[model samples]
Target: MAFSVLTINPGSTSTKLARFEGEGCVWQDVLRHTAEELAPFGTVSEQLDFRLGLVRSALAAHDGGAVRLDAVVGRGGIIDPLPGGTYRVDPVLVDRLRLGRPWDHPSNLGGVLAFSLADPLGIPAFIVDPVCVDEMAPEAKVTGLPELPKPSLLHALNVKAMVRRAAHDLGKTWNELNCVVVHLGGGVSVVAHRGGRAVDVNSANEWGPFSLDRAGGLPVGEFVRLCFSGRYSEGDIRRKLTSGGGLRAYIGTNDMLEVNRRIQAGDDEAAFYCRAMIWQIAKEVGAQAVSVGGPIDAVILTGGIAHDAGFVRLLLERVQWIAPCLVYPGEDELLALAQGALRVLRGEEPAQDYASSVLRQ
Candidate 1:
């Protein structure tokens, strides 16, 4: 019998959960908690507990619904940088995740939630293709020696989903295509999927290019000046770079939908920013395509911004010359995580002993 699996992804402001029964996606749910409401937690752990309660209540309400689920998979958390594989997360993994010492994104905490809930119920849990997709080349790792840089390929889940769905729709296997995948969300990331695997990506950490929230890779002297401003600490600068930096910083709102609404209503400022953001995406995506030597099968755009018709049209017009473009506007992380766990549960996939969690190409 095909296994039943539940997957969870906790974003900064929302918790996304889904269940997959066999090859079909049975059901999915997303529950959001506003950051303002969660401010009292002071730290991530307290916030995690508060959100876990909300999820527990949601699961309880759904317990009587359509079908019984067999296993639960939270977003994978910190497990030394190992190769891509699914494992039944044990106590060791849970301890490491709770500490959030080495790696701690809210998404990583999904693995913790999955482990806590799955183990007690005697079900299996796993984090599939975590940020630890670190197969970085030696050069990618060394950031002037002092930093020993390790930045996550955040949004790999959605990017991979784009690759999978695009391949499925294009009548080609993923391994047959070399594509540049762009995930435009509250923040953004562009990845180079080479030889059917995501060889390199830039999202939260290091600089890529200018983004909605991030300064991207800025000039050293100006960047140093900006960070040295007495008004902001390192964490403050990072928050701006990660969350507060993007469109919100520019226009005071992160809602692309609202921005587009303004554009339609004849707000020239909104239209200008929209063009600028897409242009940035187009420029970076084109560069990634160039890195792969100009043979791009499709420029795949996924995530919330990808759902915007005006933005997609703008981006396509700008970058379509690279190749045809495809839009996979939905995120399929729950399905992706569930499938990985089901493979482990059914004995069809082996739990790879990932040597280096970060696959630095």
Candidate 2:
């Protein structure tokens, strides 16, 4: 029997949801939250019930008319470092997300939202390849300074999904291939997947390439100086590093389409900055190839930014020598989530326990 599942992927201002029967998506749509609708919630966790209400209303409007869901899955968020797989949601996981300490991301609500629906219905809920899926080799975690070790936060769901897709296209299993998967979206994360394990990755939340909005990796001494400069508060510095930095910092806007338009319309400075971002991304890909050790099988680019032909062409020019460059534009996180639950339902993979030995501090 095919299992019906609800997949939830929450973003800052929008929730991407889909209803799937096994691997087939029956219904899908994005639920956008207006600023006024989200203003009351001071914290992302606080918006839980409000977001859940919206998800339910969307499902209710489905043409199937109150579809019976056997399971629910969501995009994972900041929790303790764990292996990449499907995890069964329990109070331990829900409590961790509610506390919101490990890291606060909109995706954190994914697990919360899944549980809210699955609990009373007496069905299983799962989170797949969460952002905190840490498979880093010990050397990758060393940051030279003992106090600041690198964190393995990446778009694991999409990256892994695309990697497997690419492997299938190449007539090989994902475990038999080695590739560098780059996820370029609002935040960018490049990961080295060796033998189906993500041995190392740059966290988009902390640092990597300066993406459309994120500052990425910053000069430490100058960053520290700026933090102590007293011209900004903690929130201001955090906002600057996260939401207000990168291309937005250089050109006063984060929309790459607008930047590309200006460049086409004879804006030299805009062209320069956009090219610079692509250069930085290429440099990051090269760095990860080193981490994975030489002779990358293929360099795959997947995510929203990969859709830009000009950007991809420039990036390929820089990194194509290292390996074949393939583009799998856009993310399939909603399907990735549902498939995680489907694997367990089909007994293809076992659902891991949240409080098991797999967790590492």
Candidate 3:
């Protein structure tokens, strides 16, 4: 069998699978399920059974095609600061990921499923930029408690990788460019890149101003009081933080497309929330420019929201004078995953090691 790499992205209700051999795509498909279908899984691993089963069936039916991979990579969503490059999933990281049940990001399960599938098939299993590759600068990783610092989960891999490719295509380099990469999706994150590193960004909740389904950066004292006031249980607070915060917090909906439709119909509430979302995104972009200490080379907007001209227009208007704004809207995560795996396959980069023992006891 020819060596290949499979990239699986397990979303909240959708699992996207794609196979790439060398520079070309072999197979790509999305298996969608209802929320109820996933609710019974209990853990991310259990859900993997369902997701992989779906993929197996899909593979069986993919135009009579049969292909296995040399390396199986999934968009790992929980691992942190793993050298900002492709890596073989280590047992240490996997153990921590499986046991660390505090995080509830849907994409967190992507890595577990990749490992589970790869092990049975006797192929390398890995995750690309799980929880993003952007490790914030030590000074930028501050929490209210002087002693407690945390890393931010910005889409560092996708943003940086895509920008690097874009710059290269234009005969430029990332270190020579300062740009804003906007990630618009269910979970939105915009990163400011400078000198090939993500200096300052709104990757974590403590820093983000807001997002489509996130409350974003907020006043910690007020949030702590709200958490301590006995009005919300820990679970309730988590739900709000993970999936209920943003516009959904105010209007009970997270679909920006639907929100736009309602706005066209003259629903003042929808319009108001839409405007707020755009405004908040613009504000964050401004902050990113400032973080780079001004004179940003360009503002590059990409993501689901960047596809929406109206939203893009709003952002452009908000910061047109800042610098030239470029849009690469829509996600290239699958592309980045494939490219990373290919780098290893072609000997451009090293493969991730998965057999190492866990570091934390």
- Highest lDDT, which number? 2
lDDT of 1: 0.71
Candidate 1: tens digits of C-alpha lDDT, residues 98-213: 77656455776787788777776777667776766654334444567565564555576677667867888988987677888888776678777766666556654456755555
Ranking by TM-score: 2, 3, 1
Better of 1 and 2 by lDDT: 2
Better of 1 and 3 by TM-score: 3
Q: Encode model 3's per-residue lDDT on 67-185: one tens digit a residue.
A: 65687777877644543667676566667566635566667667777787778778777777656465456666675677775566777656777677667755787568877767777
Model 1 worst lDDT run, 10 consecutive residues: 352-361
lDDT of each: 0.71, 0.88, 0.73
The global Cα lDDT (0 to 1) of model 2 is: 0.88
Q: Clashing residue pairs, candidate 2?
A: none
- Give the Å shift of residue 124 in candidate 2: 0.9
| Structural similarity to truth (TM-score) of each candidate | 0.85, 0.94, 0.86
Candidate 3 wrong stretches, greater than 4 Å: 1-3, 35-39, 63-68, 104-106, 119-122, 352-361
Candidate 2 residue lDDT tens string, 250-309 = 999999899899999999998998888888888988999998885678999999989999
**Which pairs clash in model 3?**
76-130, 87-352, 88-352, 89-354, 90-354, 208-217
Model 1 clash tally, residue pairs: 19
